[model samples]
Target: MNTTKRPIVTGIDGSGEALDAVRWAGRAARLRDVPLEIVHALDFPALLAGGVVPPPEEMKDTLRAHGQRYLRAAQEIAEAQGTTAVTTRLDPDRAAQALIEASRTAALVVVGSGGRGRLTGLLAGSVASAVGAHAACDVVVVRGDSWDDPEVADRPVVAGIDGSEPSARILAAAVAEARARKTRLVVVHASADEPRPETEPHLDPQAATEAGEQLLGELTGEHEAGGITVERVVVRGHPRRELIERSATAQLVVLGDRGRGGFPGLLLGSTGQALLHNAACPVYLVRTVS
Candidate 1:
């Protein structure tokens, strides 16, 4: 009934990871003074293909009844947070498509990784990864096992910046979050090892370091509003490894899927994908759209 707009939308499937996403989304909405929109996409094709389909209408009260349960659960989460919330159901052939569409207008979109229908060894759920890769806004993918941790609290918000426009966006968002939460903001620029002797035309080490510093200055200058403190670091190593290693002590680690001079649709490179699998905490990917 609440038609008001919120800043975040999280996909719910009653999974533990989805629940963690709900909790984090609640915290984010609270911090930003915005409502949370919880969405549950009912992919009829997926359900049918997975052999999880319900009985025919002759035996069912209504098709929407199934969707109502997820919506009701999402509403309960909002009530627990003491904020307004909206629940919407999308009937798409694919769950990922529905989530991507919903994220187009949201400030943040959240989804869970590895669910009932997931394949083994898949670090991220296909739908969640797809949404994270292509969404117009920020996307959060919650780890299922970490949801039960009782001590989960807002720690320093960390972001990876490396002289790229997308990295700039990540840095700005991290600063805003740090300011709002009164927490430290850590900006890390992680570089991979120099290409092996076998590889040709690798990145120059000196140039990379210089570029990193200039990128840091650009971001720092833009956020020099007074009062909020910022921390910057330049580490030489693989980006995803460094980010995940740093995330061991951070509450939220923000990174961009696409780097400078890269196409926007690619969420994370091989390095980012590696980190997403092993990160101890929640990892957020801010998608950059041209």
Candidate 2:
């Protein structure tokens, strides 16, 4: 197939959460049979009095040294995870900006749910959220307490589908991830009843459910042919809430950067943001190239 060599890149700041991202990225790299790159951004803003002055050489050296240490630790973690093809980069730029640039040629870019400084937060770090929204390729934000556990590989890979334009890409990525981990695939579609016009005929709930089931089957048919176990769940409710609740026991939750219900003008959709912020597991955002 398309054999473009793109590495799995992960950002680290030496925090336990960052290291968790590195660990997850390492496993993903190994599963994809690709190289892994661990990056640490040295983002130090300076205050100046009407003039800009670069930091002293000693200060810059100290930051670089600390970054090197973090990279080394991350490298060790990746190696320990059996990912031998690993590299490290020390970026002198904002974490989100650096990661976004890296995503240009990366198969996937990963970051911890929260990190130090501007990267620290509740559901996801600021850098992680920004990168996830803007990255050219897929972005995975590692979350939950068990994110660092390699044993969680057995959990099913969950994907949210809306039968939208990006549904195929989302399903493909989810199926690939499930195949990589040798886990089952859980496909969920949240069907919310929309109000029809007064002159329009009422739609049957059973027909809608049947249509959803057929769509899921058609989308995952190729993967099923390859012996992938696929389960379809079509429920009536809000898509974001349903997906968030499903994330509780999932190894990873995959979704499009924007869905059919998303605002056309927004770069990232509300459903994606909700799942990113509240999902109990790592959330993978797949964006199809325009």
Tell me the alpha-carbon RMSD of every candidate: 3.9, 2.8
Q: What does the lDDT come to for candidate 1?
A: 0.70
- Name the runs in model 1 displaced over 4 angstroms: 1-6, 47-55, 58-63, 88-93, 144-154, 193-211, 224-226, 261-267
Tens-digit lDDT string for candidate 2 (1-290): 12357999999998888988998898888788888989999875532224477777788899999999999989999999889789899988878999999999998999988888643246567887898789999999888887556677778999999988889989999989898888999999877733445885665788778888888888988778776799989987788999889888899999999877565567787888887789889999998544
The per-residue C-alpha lDDT of model 2 at residue 240 equals 90
- Model 2 steric clash pairs: none
- lDDT score at residue 139, model 2, on the 0-100 scale: 92
C-alpha local distance difference test of each model: 0.70, 0.85
| Residue 239 lDDT (model 2) | 86
Highest-scoring model, lDDT: 2
lDDT (C-alpha) at residue 231 in model 1: 80
**TM per model?**
0.82, 0.91
